[model samples]
Target: MTSAAPHLSILDKPFVLDLFAGPGGLDVAGHALDIPSLGIEWDKSACLTRYEAGLETLHADVSAVRRDAFESLPPEINVLAGGPPCQTYSVAGKGAGRKALAEVKRYIERLMAGDSDEEIDKDLKNLSDPRTALVLEPLRYAIRATRSPNRDYRPYDIIVLEQVREVEELWKHYAKVLEETGLPDGTKYKVIVDVLDTETYGVPQTRSRAVLIARREGLGEPSLPAPTHRAYEAKEWNRRRDLALAQVHQSTLDEETAPEPEARQERGDDLQPWTSMGEVLVTPVGTHPGRDTPFLVRSNYGSSSDPGRRGVRSDQQPAFTVTGKISRFVVFQHLDESIVYEGARFSMNEAGMLQTFPPDYPWSGTAQAQQVGNAVPPLFGAHLLSAALGLPTLAPEALRKPWQPATEEQRAKLRSHGCGAADDCTARCPRPE
Candidate 1:
């Protein structure tokens, strides 16, 4: 399933270069937007999944790839996006928080002290701590790309970085360096680094991530995209009313086939409420039909449910954040008004779908569930690129509709903004054939 070599000529226009590309989620979204892209990754299985999906890829460790090697890329590569592995900064991880932070600080101090790349890399390698330093690789590539004289010191016009919420402080530090760096034209990038809730952007799951967006001044101010869905407020719910079993799904779910449901019912302010776990899991095949309706049963890896943890998922509410260990998520069928459970974990496909990957997407890899859980939802990726490119984003239906390649008109509009170009070429350089 390795993709054919990409048309090198396509690089004549603006394109995306994704570092640490896991399973090509960002590249998929970029392709759907008609923007050609390439991903640099090191994981064998994740790379296999990317190739199976027909995504162009480079199976190389991103840290080892020299930025100078990218000189051949068109100068119109205004967008540089990446999501470095976040295990070290994840709240759930075992990395010593203070020690990791100190290590990062020491690394930064070394860089500021003009330590050689060889020396810094040697130290990092000797530490045997991959998570602590990988988070900073994106910034390394950015600095290399912008500071390389061989490329005339060209800079990415737009940069987007994402990681776990715990890394917001580190991102803020990176923002300072980015803000101080200037393009050849002496224009500085406007940078904003903040923590954003994925559900507010219409992701079905309630995941919060640290996001950094920067614009090479004049494109517009650096800003996070406004939320497209209603925010989840647990306190706003009246448990007696919101959690009542009688207040189940308005749309009838099929028992046998469990086909995809219709459009979402609108909530307050004419916006669709957060997508519910029931909406995502109830209808896909392999879901067990409970007595009359399906309800969620949350439990750890144990066979018996814990009263403190086991809870029912209301069809009307969005799911809690989906984690890497999806098998831990057990669903129960209410039999004769009693909760009866067998091991019914969300299938790999179901997990990917919940992450907003296309339903029929051919997901490959040994760690399928982990890949799906770690990926940025393709829908959210599309929105992010849309925001970065200053293009009108898709409707919420992006979750259900198959992605269509961008059209000539769309390319024209993107070029009009001087995206990926040395100078504004709105009138010159017609759409590539």
Candidate 2:
């Protein structure tokens, strides 16, 4: 139990558990907000990263974790936050894309049963469900154990779920499960996309991400906080300039401008493409004559890899989605002096800064670039939490920062030391600082 002297003038800090916390990006985000974090990650590297960052890490697969794990924590954990490994929905390669998305849905199904609705519905067997009976059995047990006879108040008041766009339907499904299972009767669980700009949050990159939020019953619908940055048209959404909880500054007209097809079933132009790589990735323009890394020297162009790829644009338009694979695509390749980081090098920390991590935040670990690529941006979490608590997010520092890029000499030195040769290593990340 963490007790504080009343004279200290601080409320008991909210506790957060990061499920499938890869590389502690979510943990850092919550920690920056001053929340106590307990992270569960199956990957050893991620666990080490979380541990190094001064977080409590449970080095075990979340699937293997049970309710017994919760008993080890101090009661009164106010928040549950994390994005489970998103292998199931990611549209990648031979592409073992997002494998967990289907599993999450199955997990939700099992945990969603109620006191009276126990009649297992049929026909669900054919469909692949992530949140299945097997996956969510423990959560179901946790809910059942908290019934009238047992006084286990296992009700978590808030949850910050971060997932992909395809998972939006999953949100509605999750909402339904919570309602039918009576999880939301006394709790408030809602999911909304809080797309905070990395640049606005003082990160040099123009990255974007989504956030999902939930509050235990009686806390009321959690506040959906607004963005602070305006880079790449985000600032334009500040119609009223309500700095406290201002929403994204983008025009909803882009959405309204989208010609609604005469038919309702048609696919819409995918929401104006997210901030692209050309806007963030370091170009090779200023790179040393001989120190050009593959990423640094890539052409300033899109790819044939995409269904209908667009070529390079001299105008700094959104380049394309910056996936985990940057050197392969989503990069400004070729030799040019004007590329963003052209001829210049970027550190893992610098990449993270573009991803919107706080400067003083020690991201201790090797394979820093890869770690930065895989993480969920922390500012997105900050925006969501700030919204839920109705707290002020007037900090200007979180929205913008000076860009940091590696010099040719530094890149040459690192390459000489064998750090540049193996750019694509799947090995474990180093300990977080």
Candidate 3:
């Protein structure tokens, strides 16, 4: 959890490939720090984000790239960063997750093959032979397949794999692949990390996520940045608890096991102390989750419904993870708070400010809800990245102003950018059919 790298530094201003970069959260952080990064995402909204920021936006499937193609990227991508899709691994998906697990296996297999565009190309390596899958896990064989490139590329100095849950078996397979690739067994261990509170870094939101730093043999271990904010003195505090709940997953869950549906009307009226939806939402009351707007996650803590929609009380604490899968829908509730905003309500940008995004940052999208929901809070990204790389965070002059510093009026103006200036707490969100 609190991973102490053998010792690492991004003083070199590493190049990074943000695989599955949701709206450039990780990519922007690296860029702001003067690190060159390319974001690979399949979503159009996310790609637009990359384009607007003047960063390279590669529209491709990460698992589809050839290993040689990776070489085409920066020589020492100092960090290979990405958080693979975790929807399949979520407990909420229940027994229906078999396909997702299978996908993870296939994705890793393709990655082992050198992750190239020639996924089904001529002369594909049969590395993931049926014989190899068994040794790796249910799908270990996938790692041996060597990917060919469309343009030709190679590997980076280290690969940082991010994910909501640990997926121990996946790491096991990774270690096995490293051995096969000529790296020793011990060097194959993945360095998992926990995210610090973004608020400490000046982002109004309290987002936390897991980071994995992996290195090849002889590289010593990859380094992680030290926390710049003084939120907690115990550097190790976040590390251990951040390991996440995958270790204790139900392994079996269903609608029967789901938290009993709360009474919407009752919750809407007398939401308990520390249970108000506005607090976690961090906006003026009455302008969220409806009218084509997405929910805002003030913290990772909240029902697995509309993450940004419902808010927690002033003191209940954050929920474990965020992402569309496990998060609750906004038709349910919003975090508790009553800060006023534009149109007499706050906007996603305002909410994102709460979640942390650079003020000058531009998000191009008609779907504000989906865009904000999927983003990796820039502040969230900056916190972990700067700490892991043992670097300092950017000064305000070099980036957009902090979100909370904005007056209630400034926040409302930002909210209006993506959505029409409209606030309707009563509108059903996530479009319950």
Candidate 4:
């Protein structure tokens, strides 16, 4: 059936099964597009958040799930999308990819050698690796689903996987293996892999991920969606400075003149500029209670000058990548005209907005910040899945509308009902002046 929304069609939309799903970003996107989807997530906190968000979730390790569970589904899932826990392969993880990939390679070898799970578990027991061979679980599911021993063997028609940029080479290995071994139907997969920046899809955060898209032979290969926003660049810094100067001048000229929305000047003709930090902050411009000023906290006492170190982005620029350690990134807030950096970290709500989750989204459980940081922005995930489904692309304008924050009553409900514990909730929930 066709969707009521202008950008989606559900007539041929595939049922999606997302493995290692964190906080239901892909699942949320699927729901938004009217595609049926289910998520498999093992983290208790994350699963609770999924439950709170009203997304279907199965709490279990990807390695432990059986294939029959998927194969017997009534609608028969045709799309498999997931982001394996990528810490082992992220650059931030200190060269863990090399060691982790070696383990994955060995796991693949064991599978090829007909080693039983008990045999493999015996050898891998002590590894307790955050996700040593876990990334291979999706591939295992794909292969077994296609090569089932039953009379009705229907392979997953499409697979979309993502990880840190460092994992690209490992995904290349997967592609190579798939190329050599055709499916049970004896048809090879057409694989397309790339490193995509989340900002390109209008996500306010400047995060990059390694993406893998594969279609079983006969289905047309789908291209990655074109970027709807310009990536953050060195040149944009100057534009931000000029705009800040104009706003300062305007404020100086007449304090009563409301500051022009900092966001309006950042837009362009065809491609909208990247979503900015100012656009998504909880307090609107000139309305912040304390000092109404914000600044970046780039580093601490002995940070060793890592450029990737968490820092402040101008209101005109997109936010820095939101990492699992997002709670530590300080946001300076001025109180009584005195800047205090003690506890102004971005709230869970603000962080969620930076990742493009809707304002009213319910986030529950203990690890709220990590779940938000780990999630693929659902809006962007929708774009990727939509492209995979061969649906018409939505214009940048449609996706780039202004973000709205949850109201005070809504925020109160979230806080009183015990949503995830936010690090700087005290700073975030000061009595509205």
Candidate 1 TM-score, true structure as reference: 0.76
Best to worst by lDDT, what's the order? Answer: 4, 1, 2, 3
List per-prediction Cα lDDT, in the order shown.
0.64, 0.46, 0.44, 0.66
Residue 418 deviation, candidate 1, in Å? 29
Best by lDDT: 4
Question: What lDDT would candidate 1 get against the real structure?
Answer: 0.64
Worst 10 residues of 2 by lDDT: 1-10
Tens-digit lDDT string for candidate 4 (86-193)? 776765665555576777776665654456656866776656564666777777777667555441667778888888888888787777666666543455677877
Per-residue lDDT for 1-433 in model 1, tens only? 1112222312235588888888877887787678888777767567657656767665566765653345644555567899988776765666654357767866765564456778887788755466678876766666667666656787677788888888888778777755664433344677888788877777777788888877776666655666667777665443434333333443255222222222233344754567766666555432323222455546343222333554445445566666677656776655554656554566776677678776656666588777887888877787677766665665656555433333445434433332233223322222323
Task: Please estimate how well model 3 matches the true structure, expressed as its whole-model Cα lDDT.
Answer: 0.44
- Candidate 3 C-alpha error for residue 131, in Å: 24
What's the CA RMSD for each of the models? 11.1, 12.8, 14.3, 8.8
Question: Which ranges of candidate 4 are over 4 A from the true structure?
Answer: 1-11, 67-75, 106-130, 149-151, 234-269, 282-310, 334-343, 394-433
Q: Give the C-alpha lDDT of model 4.
A: 0.66
- The segments of candidate 3 whose C-alpha lies over 4 angstroms from its true place after superposition are 1-13, 64-78, 92-154, 166-190, 193-203, 206-208, 223-311, 315-345, 393-433
Residues 1-433, candidate 3, lDDT per residue (tens digit)? Answer: 3334233463455677676677777776776776778676656555555555555655554543323234344444445566666544444333223333454456555645554435523222443332122222212112212121421333344565554443445654564565554321122433434434444444433444445455544545445544433332222333332332332344355212212113211224332211122333443322333222123323333345553444432111332233442223222222333442222233454444444555535666556555665677665576456555655655423344432233445434433332224221112111222
What lDDT score goes with residue 229 in model 3? Answer: 37
Show the colliding residue pairs in model 1. 76-420, 76-421
Model 4 clash number? 1
Model 2, span 1-433: residue lDDT tens: 1111122212246677666677666666665566677666655455445544555666554544443344544455556666654444444322122344465566566555443324332433443543333323323433533442332565665666665554455555665656445552343344344444444443334444445565555555554554343344433323222331222233353322222112221225432333333334333322211223334323323455575555433213332333454334333344543455443444444455445554433454455555666777666656555565554553524423432333445434432322113232122322223
Which stretches of model 2 miss by more than 4 angstroms? 1-12, 93-107, 114-151, 184-210, 231-322, 326-345, 360-367, 394-433
